[model samples]
Target: MFKSILVPFDGSQGAEAALAKAAELARLCGAELTLLTVYRHHSLLEASMHMVRPDEPADLDDIMRTHAKEVAERGRALAAESGIPAPRAFVKGGPVARTITSFAKEHGNDLTVIGSRGLGSLEGVLLGSVSHKVTSLSETPVLVV
Candidate 1:
């Protein structure tokens, strides 16, 4: 019964499963599917650690955004193959859980399908998993795979 469906994908196995599930739901409900890849903003100190030289300039935000775009594209392709037509994808920079939930709310998506575990391990254990946070924050229904 969903009009629009949102899936938070991170190129992880769990995320892939969630995407597949979302695709099936979209296909059955005739709903549009949107794949979202969330990346955290990197600080100067964090960007510097990846640099090999003092003179080297790191465009960490751009790099991360590019990577997130790729991840979203992959999810979109998978959804297409699963019979979800015209699936759209987006890359956003922010806190992962908040970004996902806010995007779903802002877009008026009726349902959100997300992975129970993503790339985060320490943060998941310490602060709770992103899926858990999303379920707590989102007003829409969330299905964690």
Candidate 2:
């Protein structure tokens, strides 16, 4: 019953598996798929500021954006190869969970498909789990494939 599906990709093996699943679901349902990749807006060095070199350029924002775009492009290619025509691809900068939720809301997505490892809980706290937060906060359905 899903008309639109959102799949977030991080270029990891888990994410690739999720993307394949999303593509299959979209193809089966004849639904539109949006492939999204999010890159957080800072680097470890930038966050720490421990070794700041005067001459070394620190365009962390641009770097993150570029990386996100590259990931999105790869996802797009995969979808295209799978015969999913013109799957929408977007790169966003922010916390993964919030960005994914906002993108789904903005796009009116009916379902989200993501990998479980991407939502791992570690050290008594979910460290980098976008799927967990999105499932908790999103009003739409989330399928952790």
* TM-score for each predicted model, relative to the true structure: 0.93, 0.88
Q: If candidate 1 were superposed on the true structure by all CA atoms, what would the RMSD be?
A: 1.7
Runs with alpha carbons beyond 4 Å of true place in candidate 2:
43-51, 119-128
Model 1 lDDT per residue over 41-67, tens place: 986777768765656556778888998
lDDT per residue for candidate 2 within 1-145, as digits (tens), equals: 8899999988878788899999999999999999999887775768566356655556768877997899899999998998898999999988778899999999999999988765333621635466777889899999997
Backbone clashes in model 2, listed as residue pairs? none
TM-score of the candidate numbered 1? 0.93
Model 2 Cα displacement at 113 (Å)? 0.3
For each of the candidates, the C-alpha root-mean-square deviation to the true structure, in angstroms, is 1.7, 2.6
Q: Against the unseen true structure, what C-alpha lDDT does each candidate score?
A: 0.91, 0.85
